[model samples]
Target: MDPDGDPARRVRGHGLGLVVAPVLRDYVVVDIETVPLVGTGPEQDIREIGACRVEVAPDGRHLVAERPFHRLVRSEMVSSVWGSGLSSPSAAAVDVADPDAGLITCQAALEGLAEFCAGRPVVAHNGRLHDFVVLDAACRRHGVPALHDDRLDSLDLAHIAAPRIGIELRPNADGSMPPASRSLDDLAAWFDVADPRRERHRAVPDAELTVLLIERMLKTIAGSEPVRQLQRQILQTGRNPWARFLEPPPADGSLLDCLEADTARMADSSGLSSDPTSRIGRRAVHEAGIHARAAVRLDEASVLAPLSPGGALVTGEGRAFRAQQREMAAAVLVALADGSQRESRSSTSSAGRLAVEAPTGTGKTLAYLVPAVACAQARRRPVVVATHSKVLQDQLLTDIETYRKSIGDIRCVLLKGIANYVSVGYLDAAIEAGPEGPIEALALAIMAGWATQTATGDWDDLSISQIEAAFPPVRELRTRLSVDELREFATDQADRLCFYRCALDGISTADIVVANHAVLVTLDRVVEEASHVIIDEGHNLEDGATSALTETAGSVALTALLDCVAHAVSGAGVLRRYAAACGASPPHERVDEAHDALVQCRRALTELGSHVVDYVRGRTEVTVAEAASFGVSYRLRPGLDTGRAEFARARRAARALADHLRRLSGCLALEPPMSALGTRHWRHIESELGGAAFWSAAERAGRGVAPRPRRCLQAAVCVPRASVVEPSEAGVGRYRDIGRGCR
Candidate 1:
């Protein structure tokens, strides 16, 4: 049994290949350090390489009995690339005096690593983005074929297994913060893995630390068998075990299908059995219902009595709650659960709305959450908590877990927009397309592990940007899909349920749904589900709404639109894949025609964007000052006429581009015989068409071809604190606020 032979086998249940644990007991851990120099001409110089062989016992014990392979690579090749002298630090780190005499050459080091990793899974922390890439680059530079090993990123595994720790970003010299480091040293310290090394940057020590971290994480995951069982159940059943708590019940069987498909894919990959069972049993369900019922039975007098002035307040933990928090909770509970205070549905203020402001240390989240949960349980109506930031959402999720333990089993879920999740069908397609490079291969591996372990398909739990940086295609495949279409492609109930869970489908059924304000405004289903809404950081509402309503036809948008057309034309996207599967070819001539129109439109948009930027710069007399909310801003140049001609030209160009998009959408609509698989792609294309229509309408309105109603543009631009000066009496007013930034 070759553990690394089949990828499907490796990424099955718990992402640990539990079915083939015995065969996967032996593997090598590898790490590499590189000095990246300026210039793209082969400047990656490998300073060191490290490798360790380990064996695991069936009891989950592991040993690194073999002597580790550690080597310092010669840096003479690096000197050639950098022109003469190497950096002092680089020179000191290597045997530069007689570089090749004692040290291994890059080619030799890579070959050694390949031999060591051969027929065994190779593990490293962030190997996909850093170590593995560096090693592959070195191999390419030395004319060696890349190493073919079953690679597992311990970093990816750690995120799935260990407790999530907040990444603290390091402030730059300019007061901006650099992306936080998830380095081996930092993670080891986080996991409390001892490393007594005097210096931490060395390849060998880091590799050893990575192995230790992996062992620790594996042990922790193994110990949590019940959670794993629950996850497996979710996969097999295509239903969240706690879904029974949902009001009206989640009617969509599609969610279960989607979740089960994902589970089945994972199981098939790892040769694990995908057989469903009554393993969860009636006892677990009975206990959960009991807990939920008990949680909702709070005596109004008993709960509200302590919250009165001069009365001691207590939490579910028996600790004395803060007075301010208690008071706030009392007010919220009265508004929500108090029948006497509950207004008639037809009343102007019938909806329960309570605004509370307390200092930071007052435990505002818990204060509102306790009452909200109690109210929701009592009324059997879901509560939606709208947050302005991901930080608050995470904090709320943590607090919700605490409440669940102390109070009762409340089904709370975090809801984000579709863009945050990777589509299972798309991901599977991308992997099957056979990633052409090492980075892409690594991305596939990482995603495989993540798919099996992730409860919510949201990329928030993974290092998404890092993965995308390693392989750009991963980002490309993250296209949003409609819930109904996702269900169609979902192979089983598990896949369907997973999709529903992540895409905010059936979210209304949750006891408490935590969502961002952006989701509230854009995803109508979210707002429609809740009987009451709690907006945390309520003061940001105006700004959030402003952002939600704003639109900008900027360079980024144009480029992305062009890319979409290009993908469509080349028959290289999800739609094309589905079309192929259906034995259908899209109307190639029509697509080509649309593609040509988009190309011309893109050129025009580019020109228009530049003209708009120049017009803004020329009209503003004052120096362009950077505004925190509005980016760069300046007052109109004194005595300067508003650039009416420029505005008209830009508007014309935008309208033309929108027309081109609409034409392309029409072409896609004429698609040949499509199967159910093609439905998702068709829907996405339709969405794109809808966007084009919106832009066209907006452009027409801005150009005054459509009704201008209140002439709100002029009012907005003339405001005293407006970022840009008022438009002149000329028609420039119509196009002055052309590109409003939106969330």
Candidate 2:
């Protein structure tokens, strides 16, 4: 007989189409138990076999018709403690007066069962584990493959049957029916059906109960749409319902059409306009195999698109090409060379600020790169390029390396955070010396692992766990070796960098410093002096700056500080003894200072947060004497009074910190300067505690406290050149600038 032409095979073929129809076919619920199962070896013998077959009605009435097949065999050893609860009870429980006669009866029953389920697919409750035990053991001993390969597991079916409930065959911790893993008898009661087994645990009755439970489950599931989808996944791919059904593309479909279709779908899903002229829109139309599209609203989208394509060279000569290179190196070069696109850089004084509104697929990276380098060469100042993503960071790194090789002797450096870079020297030495104890040993191992990947010298390679492993007993160890201890154990050995040293070199004086937005914002805030800065991925500027300035008073952060204090006090035991040896007071002043700051900081945060909430939602509108409502001070600007209130609390906290530092300067003294306190801490103190002088500098950078009269933040962009306007909007990039702030 042809297997494909068989009735059972024909019924399965119906699944290929997306329609559901009932078919006449029997399914068997088969289960098996193993012999010598107490041992841990892979192979085991089949001690018992059980099966019950059922037929599905066309009207969806699944009925159990056939008597079940049951078999049991004598084994050399039966573990009563473990095997007593299993399907085939212990040999002691068996009513076998004659073991030899029982073996013959069991073998005959197994043969009959196999013959009965000849062409039908068998269903089992976790059939994979049970069926494989029987199939593998029997096939090995009998020298023949056992039964069919297309068996279905009821455990999987039960999961599909109950879409909301997850599948598990184990009883719950409470010893109750765990929703989905209920026994066959309990399951039958769930559907309010009469069980023929009468609570019997024998093989034949259990199999019959399984059939009845499945019939009820199928009936319950057939009514739900979600269950139908689950059934589709089970029947089609034997995968979860979460898997998408990817339909094939239409015949004779062009790549352009696919792009258009996809773009349309994306536009719909994102709630953006599918039309090209919409405020937020994407147009993907292909011309001669080249997809010409724009994703408006995202500043980087226009520039990033073209760079993604192979063999696509971006020059500012063409419309489609010029649109993509905004802010990237290539676009920057063209803007400097071409007068028409040069006006976009009006906001920055050193060179015109290139605000490339390029869509996705536009070569924005190249646009900024070429023009920024040109501006840097023209001005003789180091151009600082900043991006948001680490991927873009690596790309810019490669770009700079390529430029150094091709575009003359220009120096560049990729500056990541110190914590991100691993210290290979420290890690290697620590591992070589080994650790003094468990914590130290764990830390050493972490450093060893970090050293292996310290190729880039970046600490971000390992997760928070790796960081903890590198510095074991992180909360306990302190004194002069605290920093050293963590550093010694850090898996971040491979990615270390001398940031301050690298910044001060003559030959190595970086012409371009590639960093992230957060790093750049920090540099801007800390460094009083300004340099030529080209903000790449500028769309993220507002959000990044806000995050840097924002403070959150969360319990976790509060708890961490408390833990730090606890660790410091605990670790001070050794420090106190050392101070005693030198005839000095304990360093309790640091704890006192931190405690005072915490109390004031907490109070300030609570008061300031309420004020900010009011400012964000409050309306300042009022009716004028002329019986007409006049709008005044509608919104808060950078220098607005309301905005100032939002930051008033943080400012007070900052001032308190500065005052605490003054007190520290007068009282706190170190014995030979704790080696744990690095230059970074001192620098932070010097900058943060320097008072009103820093606030004046910050005010100049549009970062001062918001003032009363100017209640809204307004920015004006002035470009000196008429030709700098993008071709899409001719004359829009001219010498004049316009902007207004509204509430």
Candidate 3:
């Protein structure tokens, strides 16, 4: 029987209508093979076109109907485009049809392909980068109208559906190099989708494989309730749920109104709660009461006694507590609760600070937490638990939950910087602007569901890097909202409002506030409010402090600043617009002077940064060694001095640039003509000047050869010493010398 005549091989036709539907309809999966041209022109040719129409059941199972549409188009451009007569291995891989066998012209093939697609949404693997570009170029070259249907990329879908199977590198036959693992064949194998064609790299087999991959991907997404609800909302509204946030708010009311209405409609139809607080509010309140009662019961003896070894207070669940842990907890509790302990000999009362040193697996987290929570409860002040790493923060959170059950319900909140939370207003603005690509649309969809379900709007909870990677514009959209704007937007939704209140405004009110050291150190108010603070992984404190305090005028940063100034001088950046709005055009001569100064500063900084890198590399030889207990150690070569002249020159150039910035800002801040916005810009420029000064000061302090006002720690060195060791039954081993002779 002829393959085209067989019922199983026949293509099923579906009509395309722009109507809202709860289920997807009239979808096509397409793939094309093409010969790439060396130069830009209509000099490339499409070798073949293959497509499969997909049908979805009401229950979410999808079927791929193999009505294969295959076409071979003749083109004279191939020989000229390939220059070397198509002798490349990749070119030789393609199976081209015979020119004498009545193959259709390029125009005819595209027209036939368009007819087959019927204006339906098309799906293709890596379509954004490869397939779509080829098809559009081929259409343009042949004078055929371009396919205008909505396009989706299976490559992006694969990332969302099977995130664990990231692109891997596989060695070639000669083991010379490894290629990126994004091929259709590799992806098919990864997803366990079957490709029946005997030869790979052909259009038809790849198209078929893509359809099977889509089937598996959709099945996985459909299995997830959050994703499925979002999918349905997108289909039913005929507007991408995530993209809708980018839309402009209604003129009469706030953006929050629009978000609430959309969320309420979705919740009503899908039976999901728009309010996350309803799920956890009552328990949170009850827990607060439990913590309050528990706090009142804690005195010095009660707090310290339970932690002591073999004490009567160690009965029940506390029996397994270690002696070291009990001692650490007692020290922390005494420092936190006793005001007398805070009194120093200098006649001034300073807050008592305690540092506990314990090795790994010694229950440091619980030891600190038990005392911190009890002290916070007794003192009626928040206890800040700051960690050095996210791993420790997550582990502490897990332990906190365990403690909540074992101890009492203690109210806690995880607070991060403003950048970590998504702003609904900014998202609305982006939605109004409209997403530019399929990946962006997908990211918006995922975020839409998260916006409703997430109580904190924290990016960490969702843990979807693919979404963020695909749509980086989300980061640009994370603008800082003013207090009034935040309150107005959060007024209608209790749970949404709670996030801002607990995480930002009322942070001091929470029984326990968990954060990273970066947040506590940067935000002084947080540190000031905490009656008790526990710095977990305190061994990393010095390094963390250095990183936070140090400022360097690097080449990349200088280049970016120079570019911004260039744009402003050319009347293209925010500064130019602000000046124009203020009805005072900056003097052209002043702008030119500022621009010239910045260019010189950038050159000096670049030279200085490169010299610093080379100097450090030449002086320091870092060697990794295994420690006796666990982890690794870094040994740095010592007694190397930095060039004083080089440091002085860089510092002088930085100071000159900062002075220029200050002068320019003063010109812009002229009182009579400058508006509030213009003044804000002036202030911003002043802030930049301040930053430059700070960087210069840090550089001087770090590398200064002469006596200075402040003394800075320049380097950390690990010294090794020779020791005589007696061989035991186990073996001979090296030991650290702790005596005066080693020093």
Indicate the TM-score of model 3: 0.48
Instruction: Give the per-residue lDDT digits (tens) of candidate 1, residues 1-743.
Output: 33334422221322112332223567788877776654543457787888888876645556785688888777634354457755645465556455555687778988887877777777778877767777777777779878675666776545434322335321111122222345666666656665675357787777777778777765554342333333222222222111111111122122223335544454345442211110011111222233434334445555555444443435334556477777677677666665553443222223466667787788688777877877776666678899987667767777775665455456666676555655555444343333333344344444544454445555565555655665455565444222212333646433444433443543544568788776677667777877678899999877766665554233443354455445533434433433443444444456456557656766665555554455665555323342222344444432343336645554566566556545555554434344533453343434433322233333322111111111212122222211242222321221223334322
All models, RMSD in angstroms: 12.3, 27.0, 16.4
Please identify which of the two predictions, 1 or 2, would achieve the higher TM-score against the true structure: 1
- Per-model TM-score versus the true fold: 0.59, 0.33, 0.48
After the best TM-score superposition of candidate 2, give how far the Cα of residue 138 lies from its true spot, in angstroms.
Answer: 29
Which runs in model 1 stand beyond 4 Å of their true positions?
1-128, 132-202, 205-258, 261-301, 304-321, 339-353, 418-452, 480-498, 501-509, 521-531, 567-571, 574-587, 620-652, 674-743
Ranking by lDDT: 1, 3, 2
lDDT of each: 0.51, 0.39, 0.48
Q: For each candidate, how many residue pairs have backbone atoms clashing (under 3 Å)?
A: 25, 59, 7
Q: Which of the predicted structures, 1 or 2, would earn the higher lDDT when compared with the native?
A: 1
Which 10 residues in a row give candidate 1 its minimum summed lDDT? 275-284
C-alpha lDDT (0 to 100) for residue 207 of candidate 3: 82
Give the per-residue Cα lDDT of candidate 1 at 83: 70
